[model samples]
Target: MTITINRLLLRADTADGPYGTDIVFEKGLFILRVENTHGKSTCINSIAYALGMEMALGQVTSKPPFPPSLLKNIQNENGTEIPVISSYVMLEVSNDRGQTCTLKREILGADAESIITVYESDIESISNNGRNLFIHLEGDTSRELGFYYWLAEFISWDLPLVPNNSGRESPLYPVLLFPLFFVEQKKGWSSIQATTPFHLQIIQARKRAFEFLMDMDINETVNSKAKNKKLIDDVQEKWKQIYTQLESVAIRLDGKAQGVKDAPAATFDPFKLDILIEHQGNWQSLTSALIGLRADLTQHVKASQPQVAEQKNESLLSKIRELNNIVLQEDSKYEFLLNEISFVKNQITATEVRIENLVDDKRKYEDLKKVKSFSILDDLPVLNNECPTCGREYSDHNVEIECSDDLMTLEESLEFIKSQITTFKSVLNSYKMQLDIKKIELSKLEKQIDKHGADISRLKTELYSERNVLDEESLREKIRLENQITEYEKGLVAVGDFRSTFDILHNQYKHLISLRRNFPEHGFSQKDINKLDGLKTKVVKYLSEFGFSSFDPQLLEISQDTYLPTREGFDLGFDTSASDGIRIIWSYLISLFSLREIFKTNHPGILIFDEPRQQEANKFSFTGLLKGASDAAKSGQIIFATSEEEDVLKGALEGFKYTLHSYSPSEGKILRKLNKGA
Candidate 1:
């Protein structure tokens, strides 16, 4: 895949002033040159921000290369600065398929919230086009529609959903692709492949990115194994829980607690429990005996009569009726109190809303008063000699009229409005307080009503006690029989649950074991080995061309274990000088870029080098690096930023195919004055 940046726009808002820059690129090498601290890194990072791949820049400090920090504290005249209120990065990009898109992302001051917008347009018509017909990508880290996710798909990188070290699944984001594309000025010199020290997890992601780019299919197996392990652990925990509950149930039924039996070794067999139950006749006998006892107890209850005789009394019944009437009256009062409380609550809600509106109105008027008032003189009506009131031509002295000086100003009007809003808020708050007091009174009334209800219930119970005619011994006998029947039924239920628990555990255990055996261990295949060998050869070739002298090409090897270049079959990454380390990075990444075409890879065909010569002292090797990059330009796009002198660069690569945007302290910086036409 080939992606070319046609234009980049950065718009900034600062307290002192607003300024921005626009750079246009063609199909060739582009060098953005400036002195140190002149915003070269800022220009490169603007592209990453517009693409929503800011995380690829690694950890950001309070300086440039981090788009947010650069925008928040923009530079101004005489080394002064101002806080930025808003900032945006826009880019017009085209792909190998001839599809053109204008992408933009905006940030509001220091806040992290950003709006990502993209517009797909025709390449021929894009120069005069504004990004009006754009779509905003929405969602979060886990969503498929997020800005980063959409960009990855738009570039046709078929990144799969893989499991992280935490056993959580995440989609492949654009940051994962940065190791082979972006070279950070700070950490890019630390390794053959640029690394981020954000966490150990990102280290693992680096390995995953390499594996994915090589077209290895083992990630699916790895993800499946992770998911299977988590499922098995959860199932085992559930089995332990069920065993404990089953033991408690057995003990409650007057049976000795037995340890849960082992799961069956075969497939889940629901009939196994049925065969066991048939062999044990105790359960059947217990069920039969409980049923017969229940029938006898029912008949005895039906034939029994009251042990003591009662004499009817009209006066006692009348007193019971009077107590019942008091209960009904108390219930009515309780319902009324509840309704009144609800009504008061609604009234409070309305009053609070009114107060909120008034407060907002007051704030608006106060803000309006602080702003500078518009001058009426700037847009005064155009007057001519025929503008006389009677439609007759008149002289300037005759048409002259005096304006009043005592008119009310907007500030005075705003002050009156503010006072009225304050007064309305005060009245609304007073109403809310009054409603709260009413709610409190209603609560006390409800408590009193409950006490009256309890008194009525006690009276009814006392009246019923007087009417009870059964002997105490007979009541005790009936209660004992009922308790016996309940215990028998509970025992039967416990026996049934014991068998059911065993069946469910047996089924779940068998299913989990089967799933575990089906997932095989994932290892690299022959195709992976062949790709690694090809990458190693390319690395050796490019390293030699880039002027690295220490290691032999035959002895130089790419570590399959580390996916990093090794010297003499040993890890020499830390032993090498910083300049050599950068050379290794250059060779390693450009080899990947070359192999992408050989392997038909999805690399987006763009590489960014902020300052490859930052730590190197030798200018000769740096020129060779530039020469190699120019040769690779036939395959993709390379955007390089440097502080090296122009004449030296011209002499080093005399026939180099590239473009230059050089700047100096007196000539102005990369971030130029804002365009008034934009």
Candidate 2:
């Protein structure tokens, strides 16, 4: 059964379509639609609402994203109150069973029980043997549903067909057509991604075509001579640069010590240093044992009557003791220096590299999508006897040519730059690696240096006290400093940890910059910012080609930070600064295209358009779309609601026939809805 909207009611001032309407049908097709000004679109919208076609009926209302302080304040000029609520749409539907259904819907204030509610009119059985079925909107009506129930009704033969329902009514026929064909509009032009590898079928063709072009160009100039000159000049220049840089480095190398911030004292352990003093005492004791052994040897020599020489034995003993002392002192000094140097060097290097990487990241982000031009690129031919622009007869006018591209040009430049930076970074990284080693070295130095301060102070105190034996005070100070050094060495493990509290952020950064995707074959491409600048130049070039003025070219700019051009910018839209009528035409086209896309993907063959000729200015642009839709509707059904100028509709819908219907509370102007099928 076919169902359609017939009429609607609304206050004169509202843009929300109609508040109430009728359900009228004839034969099997819905007939007699009233425009929104006449309150029809709103009415049918209600039916669309009942059928779950729209997210909501009436306008979509949202709170302002910002406070009023951010907005312009306009006071009421006449102190007149605007209606708080928007108007609504009422629809009339009837099927083959002669069952007529009226649906009414509207947006309610937030305080209202429901954002939207449906109201169904009582079933008015139009024929015998029809069962009452006005229970579609709900099992029962309440205030929550608002005034919808009272405003709508079903009047058809099927209303009384069921047993124990109301009464029985006659049968009604089914509906035939409601075919929909929407018009599409064009917008801005955009280039598609085309640099993708040529598909297998077209790769060789592209290669051959470019090679031929290059060879033809080569014929115009002597490339071989230029290559020879470049090679000669490059080697000569490289050697000259190397010799000068080496000389410059020799002259500039500064051996003067760096300005030292006093390496803070490395507090040390007297207890450990004193172990050396204990070893000396052991040496002294050994010397006494040697003395005793020598006495015994002297007595034995005396008894052996001048067989042994005492002076020779004493000299050998002294030499052995001196060698032992030399080895131990050198080894102790080497151990101390290693710990001191490692820490400071690492800290300085890491800080510097971090600064450089951030500097490199100032220019950033865009979403990459597959380019749409891949198909066209693949289909382009390699060898052609005729012109590429037109399929034409072969002529002897053009010459054949072959060429080769310098593959090394791009690849070599990238490789060279990457290698230089990578090598420089490696040197810098070594400096960083030495940092921890330096930290440990520095701590050892501090411990060594701390004892000197104590000794100096002890000497000063002894001198102040007028003590004759300053050595005693020096010994006591050394012990105190040594105890402190032992404490510091114990804490070395914790102090040597160079890691800052940033492991988590490091993990995330690793993901962003270095995580390699599995699909490396798909590859990645980076366009130079200079390339975008080049594109801008080309945009100006094109605009000039189109006769745009030099001072104010009518070309669009695209930027990552701010994008101003949209799909509808080039060929359509109110935003395009087009004529009002043109704007409406564009808007209508877009709407039709969108509707078609949606319905084509999922069939809900219905349309509910309002203000097709909006704000009076859209009349001219909207005229064509309306006419097209009307023409398509001859084989189907479409319900358009508008408060448009009547002359415009008459002009656009000139050939189509529509039942004229009107609505009003004023007596003698009433056109109540009727169910023709019943």
- Tell me, by TM-score, which candidate is best: 1
lDDT of 1 at 188: 66
The TM-score measured for candidate 1 stands at: 0.60
Weakest lDDT window of 10 consecutive positions for candidate 2: 170-179
Across 100-167, the per-residue lDDT of candidate 2 in tens digits comes to 44443333323222233333332342233322222223322222232222222221112111111122
Q: Which regions of candidate 2 are displaced past 4 Å?
A: 1-416, 421-577, 580-600, 614-622, 634-637, 657-678
Q: Model 1: how large is the Cα RMSD against the reference? A: 27.5
State TM-scores per candidate: 0.60, 0.33
Residue by residue across 349-382, what tens digits does model 1's lDDT show? Answer: 7767776776776677676555434454333232
- The best candidate by lDDT is 1
